[model samples]
Every structure is written in C-alpha cells, then in structure tokens.
Target: MPTPDLLTGELTLTGRITTASNATFLGTIGELVVVYKPRAGESPLWDFPSGTLAHREAAAYKVSEVFGWNIVPHTWLRDGPLGEGMVQAWQEEDPSQNPVDLVPAEAVPGSDWKQVLRGQGEDGQMVALVHEDSAALRRMAVFDVVVNNADRKGNHILAMTEGHRHGVDHGLTFHHEHKLRTVLWGWIGDALNADELEGIDRVREGLQGQLGQQLADLLSAEEVEALALRCDRLRSDGQFPAPSGQAPAVPWPLF
Candidate 1:
C-alpha cells in the first residue's frame, strides 16, 4: 500500500511519475512516494480500477495475518488533492535509490525498526538503503510466490535498520496469473525454511477456521481459492515448490 506524504497533511504533487501505472509524484505530504490517484481532470483520466486495487491490497493485509506478518499498515480509502486514494502508513527511505540501489547492512546508521540483509538482486539493478535485519523477509518471499506479485521491485521491500523487512506496493498482486517479479531473487528455486514452513502450517490450519472467514471479507472467491491453493502446495511440498507457471521467469522492473 502506498502512503500519502505527512508533511503536507495530504499529498500535493509537484511533479509527475509519467512512467508509472498509477499517478505518482515527487511531492511530500510526510514520507515520500505520495501516490496521487488520477483526478477526473487529470491527463491519465480517473478510471481507476479502484475496486480491484483495493481488493488486492486489502487482501494482502488479510492473508498476511495468516502468517502473523504485518503485511498492512494503516490504510484507508480517502480523497486527497488527487481524488479518491488509499492513504497508507509511510515507511522511511529515500525513493531516489529505488529500482536498484543496495543498502548494505552498514548503511543504516541509526536506531530503527528494520534491518538490511544481503539479498540477491539482478546485476545493474538499483538498490536503496533499506532499513537493515528483516524480521519476516523470508516469510515475505513465500507470500510473494503465493500472491504471484508481478511488481516485487527493489523498492517494494523496505528493510529498516533494526531488521523489519517490509513488503510494499501490493497493488499488482493476485492477478489470477503467475507473474512473480521481485528483487528477492536471491531465494529463487530455494526451498522454504523451517520457520517459513511453520508459518505456512499456521496459515493452512487457520484457513479452514478463523483466517478463512476473515479473508472472505477481504478477498474474492477466486482470490481465496488461490490463497488456499498456495498454502496447500506449501504444506504438501515441505519446501519452496517449483515455479508452476508458464512464464520463463518473473517480469522486469519489479516496481
């Protein structure tokens, strides 16, 4: 989920992110990455697939609960200067190094909540000073596969200095297709770890009980099925199962 800048109370766009799918800006309401929704008079025109976007993002939060991972921040649908938008709690980092900058564990210089772990990324990819030891990064990798995230770019995973790896930009997830793109390629083809397996087990057990009912409110029938399928596969595999999709690999420009 993208957040509104805090400094401005609302995100006021000073510039445009022409290259993005949603209307993006270089402005600051508080933390950076203020995503402005396309207003009625805007160039892109406001025909936002709001229902789908919100559904997916909210579902991310819901399914994350299955693993006991904090996949969601404070997100609410609100109107900003741009129009209807989703306001998210902001994570700290400079977006300038987005897409391919690496935050070595040493780069984080203060007391913070996230930690930077060395993860595999493509060559020439930009890296940022993600807050360093991600508490649930490995868990996040598993989540990405289940959701089939198509935009797991470098910027999406924020590693705070103290080690909480936060996964963001979940708008492109749950397409009912297998298009998993991301910067956490370091774990490609790797098997699930013991803790990760435990998390999956927890989710699997919960799916038939409380978590499934909770997800019913947040996800579509298909989405819920997909979630169940992913969980089932993990339980059966006892490992990070192989990529079962038709694509050669995950897409480019993870963000």
Candidate 2:
C-alpha cells in the first residue's frame, strides 16, 4: 500500500478512462498502478451534491470494508495532477472470464448463471444478459443496495483470475432517496440468506457507532440518516428488493 504522501506524489497518466461520465485517468505512484478521478473533472449532476463524487467513491470502499466483503478495491482521496480526487488500486481482470455476457436466449438454463434480462442483440438474435451467480457477485449486489448505488453498470464488475469479483465506479451512491439502479437485479425478491441477513445486522449496528461516524466525514447528515434507514428497511423486509417502479430499474448502455 502506498502512503498518503507517496500517493500524492506526481501522477504520471498512463491512459484515460474514456467511458466514465467524468474525466478519469489510469496512473501510477512509483510501482503501484492506480485509477485517479479528480474532483475538478467531475461533471455536475442535478440529483447528487456537486464535486463530492470522489468522496462518495472512498465512502463506498469504507462500507465494503464494514461488511467484511472485499467487493470494492482499496480506495482513498488525495491530491493528484488535476485536483483532489479518488484514488483506487487497479485490478487486472482475468482475460478469459467475461463478467457479463449476452448468451442466446435459448442457450441459458444452468443454475450457476443468473439471467438478468432478455433483449435483442445487434445481430438481431434474441439474447439474455447473464452473469455468474457466484458468492462474490452476490456480495456486490448487497453492497449496491446498502449504498443506494444509482449506477451499477455491467462493466463495473471486474472478474479476477481466482474467481474473485470486484465492483468499481461507485461515485453515484449514498443518495438520500431511493436511487438504486443497477444490472445486478437477478436476486430480486429472493429471500436473504442467514449470512446475508447477519451482514445487514452488523451494518445497522455500526451505523450507531464507528461506521456512521466515519460516513459523517464523507457524506451529509441526511445521507447518513438515509443510510441507516436503508439498513432498517432491508432488515425488516429480509429480502432483496424489487425495482421501486418510480425510476428506471437499470442504467442505459448496460455494458
């Protein structure tokens, strides 16, 4: 791990993350590979407070740690070449494993896969958007719900060689509203397993103590209350929630 001063050292941009809504860069601090998203480069959004996306990214990492599920990679906030931004460890996804795939509609049947939705592919063939029903992916879905993640695009999931799945690009989170939008809704309406419910319980307990205090440093008071409320709702409901029916359930350009 790079120390704060080392991470704040000169950032040499290796490449730009063009698909991001805001300006993002792939850079390195000495031998460590990192992704940097400067606050100055953030495009303002009407719903979220201005210029705090980088902070939210770091907060999401904290929440991931709270759950003891390594769904999110190590992240921090520091000054970079552009401005203050979120810096995260770079994950090299397995070249052979695709996290999300468009398989033929008729070709999907295995219990190991969860079909998220069906649509027509560019080739005019009926296809199903599917992801592996692995424990890592399931943990990520739970993390999304806890944070009220507004955008969980398919490509945000990284598949590592040993089958570990890491979620990235969590800037659109911690909203005080029901802004849960994502492609990982395969477990909709499913009952929460005992372990999953226990995780939620731990989060609820943390909100009244250390986790809540840490979140206060990165999020607004209202957002912190909303976070606690989400834990309450999930605990009471005891299931993965379905779409609220008030907003789009999934993000556009799913990939």
- Encode model 2's per-residue lDDT on 1-255: one tens digit a residue: 347656667777899989788999999888888999999999989999999999999999888888888888999988888878999999999978976777899998599889999989999999998888877887788889999999998889999999899999999999999999888988989888887888888888888898888889999999989998998999899889989958898888887
Q: Model 1, 69-154: lDDT tens per residue?
A: 77555444456675655445566754443323455444544443233234445664433434222336667778887776767766
Task: Give the Å shift of residue 103 in candidate 2.
Answer: 1.5
Which number leads on TM-score? 2
- Candidate 2 error regions (>4 Å): 5-7
Candidate 2 versus truth, CA RMSD in Å, comes to 1.6
Q: Which segments of candidate 1 are over 4 A away from where they belong? A: 1-19, 24-51, 78-84, 94-135
User: TM-score for model 1?
Assistant: 0.65
Please report the candidate that would top lDDT against the real structure: 2
Per-model C-alpha lDDT, please? 0.59, 0.89
